[model samples]
Target: MLEFDFCSTVSSIFSTPFSLGMFTEPLMLLAETAPPEVVAGDLAEPSEESLFSVGGILTLGMLIVLQAVLGFDNLLYISIESKRVEESKQSMVRKWGIGLAIVFRIILLYVVVKVIALLQEPFLNLISHPLEVHLSGHSLIVIGGGAFILWTAIKEIYHLLAVSDLGEEGDKGEKGNSVTKAISLIVTMNLVFSFDSILSAMALTKSLEIMATAVILSGVLMIWLADHVAEFLKKNRMYEVLGLFILFIVGVMLVSEGGHLAKIQLFGYHVEAMQKSTFYFVLAVLIIVDVVQGRYQKKLLARQAKLRLAEQPSA
Candidate 1:
């Protein structure tokens, strides 16, 4: 030990900085301890600080779940809309669309978190008496988005029912808009769909970080699901009809929400917003009915095939 190699020691000392530089913060963080065990639980069995963290996490989780639920329609819309592009490019469009939507959502979150009240401010008024007509920026977006989606859904239904191979036609450049137009619409609708969830999240907990996290998580999930939905529709075209119908209902909800934003009343009946629970219940019923019908149809087909085989003479 007294006769240490001075050259080797100097080399080793110089290499220590290089070794440390190679390990990034993230790499170092991989060996973290359990916080409570490491910090001795900070202050005892449980503290207000710990409880507050748990509450924040719970709220974040709730917002995330809420965003996912409300974004079902938006995801459906993306799947359906991406068909306007070349078949090979549809998936790319979906991924990019969602990526851009997430960016836009975070930007919108910052903007809305600061000026939600301004968005809800009643400015433009067409009438002011018993049939008081007024509008806010928020109401305008909701109403316009509702009308756009309603038109799109109804148009898609009509096209699907009246003519076959709408997707194929688009592939052939016969029933499609420009790719730019398609992506623009996707982003716009995503914004409209996000408004409710973001507003609700703000109301629940005034934490921009939590709300943004929720939106980002929801966006990631939607991106993952959009592919599955598009693939499912491609494989099982029959379900496209069901998806379109659900989208139609989404439009109705948007319109109702917009009406609530405007506080419009007519014939002693105030135009009100649809509850999320009610919307989900109705959607569940629709899905159940569609699934039951699909199973019944399969059984009927199978039975018919059996009957046909029985009627065929021995080969």
Candidate 2:
């Protein structure tokens, strides 16, 4: 009954938005962070090919699908972030935020391809006999982005717990978000999320056009799904706890990646990226456990009700 009411309320809230979407950062978070792989062996630069050529079309199609898969975490973040805004303006914020993401990605796609080597250069380094540290623009970005996400996740969790009754950060979750601020944060994090996948895309092919096309297509899909994802979460609030924890873990992974990129070492232990396969396996286990636990609890409640009825008849 509680769940049913929640659904009805969600329907009333989003009835007009016909709305809108993350899927990537968390996967990276659970795995070891590594610099984007630059494909080995000299591959030919992307050449201008006929749009209708079988190879070009096939490559473009594969990339589009891949972008959607890789961007799920990205889409999830957008969905969650949009909910932090004024209810009346959520639809607009989500739509505009995604539009900006598409544009920023395209611009970033070209810039990274042009000056990627410069971005990879380490700009600072320090060392001791058993420990060393280095930092680069890329590493800095990862660290900064990770820190922001960590702060946001922790803050949201606190809000969920109502831990602010004694202070300013406590219960103002009902306040409307500044549209500008929300959009800015979305765009910034979206770029951080793109850093790796964009590199992976380059490793597969040299054609910038193919990458751009895939990005645009995926953004379109995101715009379509964003509202719907937000609504689902609003109705099924329990799952939002799971989503917040995933975001928190993603922040941890990004920070680890930054540490790895800087090649930090302490007490003879070098920082490293976690393996992707292991993280996915763990995520699968968590989902299975949550589902089983929920079902088992429901069954237990039903059993208790039966016992109560039997005792009443005896009395």
Candidate 3:
């Protein structure tokens, strides 16, 4: 039977030799102040104590809410990516993509829990007069994912502008590789978006089961919401532009976060991560502007139609 030592477990979960030593003293102080049973290793077994408790359940709820809040951009990406395939296969792609991603996310959570310190260790360092970057696994993954999303958004927006007939283009869907490609992209980006959420959950508690449960529940919610969002975009084609721009903002947020994580400096200027509050503020403004402009455009067209009717001779 495996023995459970509370102090050691907390220490291992939060820090390794390679990690910054900021947590070591605080953790030691906590261990010193804890009850004799907790500090002297006289506690109940791990299975009994950690699996389901008031604290664990409360942490679980917090994790679920965190996953949902962070997953909004990811959900948007899935909705838009699924639309590229045939109408019949789009739903399958979403279900399969998220299903596979859920399995992989659990796997990723396990792996990250084990080697989180290694992931944060700086593996690539570039120092020059003009550029300076300290790249780690986490930063590289986020930066790469952000760049891909940015490229996809720009390409899709360009296609929207270049196409002569929007309705005709919407009717024609891609065949052959579209379904496979869409699913692959959806799963990949889903993992990218999961990193920060997983790390945040880790900060709350060290229970793998609790975190995994939250992830599964959040993924289930996403699967249910995916189709509705896609259908909405389909019915209101004008909002597609709004959706794509939101995606663009998401990309920017990810890239900035990665740069901040890596402590990147270009031309002697540091890169800072965009705050979540700022991102949401900008998003709300964008949505309000889009809605107001759409309504104003409709009213203008209505007025034009009325004037033209009045100018015509009575029939």
In terms of lDDT, which candidate is strongest? 3
Candidate 1's TM-score reads: 0.77
Q: Is candidate 1 or candidate 2 better by TM-score?
A: 2
Clashes of 2: 23
lDDT, model 3: 0.79
Worst 10 residues of 1 by lDDT: 25-34
State the displacement of the C-alpha of residue 5, model 3, in Å, after optimal TM-score superposition: 20
Residue-level lDDT of model 1, residues 49-167, one tens digit each, is 22147666766665676677667889999988888778878888898889899999989877775566577677877664566556888898999999899998999888877766667
Per-residue alpha-carbon lDDT of candidate 2 for residues 1-315, written as tens digits (9 for 90 to 100): 001122343355456442111123332332223232332111234455434676667656656755776566677778778777777788788899989989999999888776666667788888887888888887888889888888988987877797445234222344456889888878888999888677656644556777788889888988898888888877666677777877777777778878888888988798885443444555566668777877898899999999998889554
Each prediction's total of clashing residue pairs, residues at least 3 apart in sequence or on different chains, is 0, 23, 0
* Model 2 spans > 4 angstroms off: 1-50, 163-173, 308-315
Model 1 CA deviation exceeding 4 Å by range: 1-52, 128-130, 164-175, 312-315
RMSD of each: 16.5, 12.1, 8.6
**Per-residue lDDT tens digits of candidate 3, residues 1-315?**
223354464466456553222232233234223332332232222434354887677667766776877788899999988987888899899999999999999999878756666777789999998899999998999999999999989988998899898778889843445778889999999999998787666555556788899999999999999999999998999999999999999999889989987989999999987766677778889999999999999999999999999999998
Give TM-scores for every candidate, taking all chains together and pairing residue i with residue i. Answer: 0.77, 0.79, 0.84
Ranking by lDDT: 3, 1, 2
Residue-level error in angstroms, candidate 2, position 163: 5.9
For candidate 2, the TM-score is 0.79
Model 3 bad stretches (over 4 Å): 1-51, 174-176
* Residue range with the least summed lDDT across 10 consecutive positions in model 2: 1-10
What lDDT does each candidate get?
Answer: 0.72, 0.69, 0.79
